[model samples]
Target: MEGPPVKIVALAIQGFVGQVLLDAGGNAKVNKQQFLHQVCKRIHSIGKNLFFEFKEKSFKLHFLMYGSYRVNEEKSR
Candidate 1:
């Protein structure tokens, strides 16, 4: 099945406050709390990795096999 359109994903996250759960990979020294209250400028993906772009910084999220994510959803017990 095809996933949602990129524009839809962007609309869901763009201009919304975001949080970082872990430091970004490679040499980037991204503080986990740095994204707090920052508006997400855009969202894109390459291969299995997703990216969240901000005004001065961007983050990458690499999903492993079978990995999944949810937006605006409560955690299941």
Candidate 2:
């Protein structure tokens, strides 16, 4: 089955938080602050990877077999 429509996706990601978490093997030269206030130009997925593209940077998210995510909802710790 297909996923939700693109318009719904866009509305869900309308803002950006000014933080980035890098992997242990990720590029050391990348400045995480560069993403602050930068607009997300596009969003797409390839295979199991989800990509968020900015003007000068992009990040990819890949979930493990049982990984999951929540949007606009807070989980009590």
Candidate 3:
């Protein structure tokens, strides 16, 4: 089945961290594509954050910007 494409755009905020996007409500549209926009629409940040590109019945996530992060570190390096 073919239908109109869904467009989603999101902007990133500076120094924004510990964010999440949870689709608690299941898909209500006819198909997955219709309800997938919520992924990018529902985001918590200073300005804007989180993005998605719906393509071929799928989606691609993109991080416009990121906060500084490190792992595997000791108390004193």
Instruction: Give the per-residue Cα lDDT of candidate 3 at 44.
Output: 32
User: Per lDDT, what order, best first?
Assistant: 1, 2, 3
lDDT of each: 0.57, 0.53, 0.29
Checking candidate 1 for backbone clashes, the offending pairs are none
Model 3: residues with Cα > 4 Å off, grouped in runs: 1-56, 67-77
The sequence of per-residue lDDT tens digits that candidate 3 reaches over residues 1-77 is: 01111112222332222232233222224344353333332423223333332232323232334422122333354
| Candidate 1 vs. true structure, TM-score | 0.59
Give all TM-scores, in the order shown. 0.59, 0.55, 0.18
Candidate 2 runs further than 4 Å off: 1-33
Tens digit per residue, CA lDDT, model 2, 1-77: 12333334434655533333222232336565666567667766565556678777887756546444556455557
**lDDT value, candidate 2, whole model:** 0.53
* Number of the predicted model whose TM-score against the real structure is largest: 1
Q: Which residue pairs show collisions in model 3?
A: none
Q: Lowest-scoring 10 consecutive residues by lDDT in candidate 3?
A: 1-10
lDDT of 1 by residue, 1-77 (tens): 12344335445665454554332223345664676556666677665666888778778765555545566565577
